[model samples]
Target: MTVSDQENLLHTSSYYAASANDKSMRSELIGEQSCDVCIVGAGFTGISTALHLAEQGLSVIVVEGSRIGFGASGRNGGQLVNSYSRDIDFIKHHYGDVVGEQMAAMAFEGQRIIRERVATYQIDCDLKEGAIFAACNNKQFNELKEKKALWEAHGHDQLTLLSASSIQEHIGTGRYAGGLLDHWGGHVHPLNLVLGEAKAFESLGGVIYEASEVTKVTEGEVCQVTTAKGVVSAKQVVVAGNAYLTGILPDVEKKAMPCGTQVIATEPLTPEQQQAILPSDHCVEDCNYLLDYYRLSGDGRLIYGGGTTYGAREPDRVESLIVPKMLKTFPALQGVKIDYAWTGNFLLTLRRLPQVGRIGKNLYYAQGYSGHGVTSTHLMGKVLADALQGDTERFDVFAGLPQYPFPGGRMLRVPYTAVGAAYYAFRDKLGI
Candidate 1:
């Protein structure tokens, strides 16, 4: 959000922005406001948390630096990706069986929460069902098989593993070795989804102030959050800014680095092109360290996204960077006209797991979802609201997870992570 200009504060020049349902902005916070809970951010986490708390009859106010869903929540691949970035197998191997089972049980709950919200609120975000994780090689394909079995054991049986040949049924690409489809997974127009949630929050008596950036937070029995033009006092504060939360909370900022991922949407594809590119119209994410994710938009455009620029640095000519990846997946789309290209940032922790905890007895925070946040943020909202209501069982489990600062600190985190990613990407290329 620290862009050179101020207009960019409202929303980036993204396909989502161009198609946002709500172009109107909320007024900035003025003078003084008070609430039972004050959340800093208007993205998925903030809006989701606010909606959850409001559903339970709590007074909540969200102060955002920009418009609702202006961050990664509005700019991601828009896939309803279930589970955390680390997944259940990694949790089971490293954190033991009980913890793993606990995580697995809640893995698909985010999707359920999302579906419930859409139905309850009658949100029109172009909700569609089905998603696939394609593997580039047999090794990666085997890993997907293992994950399928592991997920099934944890009671997630909406999975179907595809052989190399069967993979073509879902995607037109021959580059993938195999894939795993999730019947419950889907995609959405992300910005509209968050905007709809914000509206839903408003309907529940929640308050939100757009373009009101918090400059300082003084924690006490009653926390005081100071913004550019106003102040908010609250009994509890929840920090949900994620990558954009830098400078406000040094501890949380150091534990995660801002990562920029770019996306490009080709001009609306014809019916024939759509069938060849994304048969069945299911969203697809590859099983690579730096994976590529793409799907057919509601209007039939091919929205493809991949590549990373760490430290929140937006690269020049995003189209040039992403078009190659898109071509590799669907070569027939070589000469397709690109209609949109934009970059969005998400917080990435060293361990690639979300960081959830409290600064004090009254301040709670959750961020660093890595790249899998669409559903996870909704899940965190439920857990955080429950935790605030004295149900800390799930929240405690997540908070207990280890959170470490970057190795080289802020000065070298970008290069350090880039090198590490290069290594893993190299391994992905060699199929090992």
Candidate 2:
């Protein structure tokens, strides 16, 4: 398909794209321009950084390959689940307590930042509260209790444990044994949220150019980023492309692999049907290596998502691939008709914790959010801006964390990670 044809295809295929709030098309970068910071990629990290820095009176220019929120930021599962992709215990075990505790303190900061921005900017993204972590079996249910305690020990007290008998109170389906409800966790129209943020950034005097893909970067005290139609010279450059940052920065690319996840939205359900699926209207994600997360759209459609493509390629018949998992979660919806199906890629790191730091003290970058980009990206956006402003205390904590490239390098990392995912899937299946 042609570029326009592909974008049209994606726009029609994703529920978010179809339902996004209307916004003016931004102009593409046309000529050489100078700024305090020139960011490549207008996704959450880039846009959020632009807004933060603009608040501090920095001249910011954002260059996006496509329109804002065109990537995973606009098309994710929409569940605002807190914490990093990897739990804090893992960081504490592998790293030391000081680093682990420091990371833990910032676990829920992303959600707070998002909420603050939305209310301050008067964003209307159909924001809702509460999220449920459904347990698949007894082992997982017990683990939920432990998770609550662990998070409580780390200053998170908004969690409530539910027993199997009370599971139906939160979810309509009988698939879950029990779950932990996070009062702070919630869902939203992701595209609307980002679009609103972009508007907010513009209101703060930040410049944004869409359809401007960065082609080359000349690193120095003054970084020069060459796009297809323009060159942006700035004192600092922030590479916030995440998984889509392929080939632009090989150093950041080496530490992560791109993986695609699929999501499908059903036709608007009857009010009764909507109530029958999710009684509390809270987003639900199961506890599994390869888990299923689903929520009800503001218009009453069941938006269910799961299944990962390890090689970062789109799955054939995306609806067919995701429907079975949806049925397994809600058998009552086995015959429900799906209205939209789409796939988006996320950067997955070996340790699953996001990698945030500067490249040679001039080029700043943050990626490898795994599946936790929704909340983590916002936190990193602020962290990126703060570090650029010379407040490096919080940024230094993440930068100090160890990073390693995938063992097989570019040639075999995909297959290697795929094999590792398969092994973990087997373990999750056997409850080992």
Clash counts per candidate, in order, are 0, 0
Model 1 lDDT at residue 109: 92
Q: Write the per-residue lDDT of candidate 1 for residues 318-359, one digit (tens) a residue.
A: 998999999888889978899899999999998888999988
Candidate 2 wrong stretches, greater than 4 Å: 1-12
Lowest-sum lDDT 10-residue window in model 1: 1-10
Give the winner by lDDT: 1
State residue 14's C-alpha deviation in candidate 2, in Å: 0.5
Superposed on all Cα atoms, model 2 deviates from the true structure by an RMSD in Å of 1.6
Write one digit per residue (lDDT tens) for candidate 2, span 348-369.
Answer: 9988888887877689888899
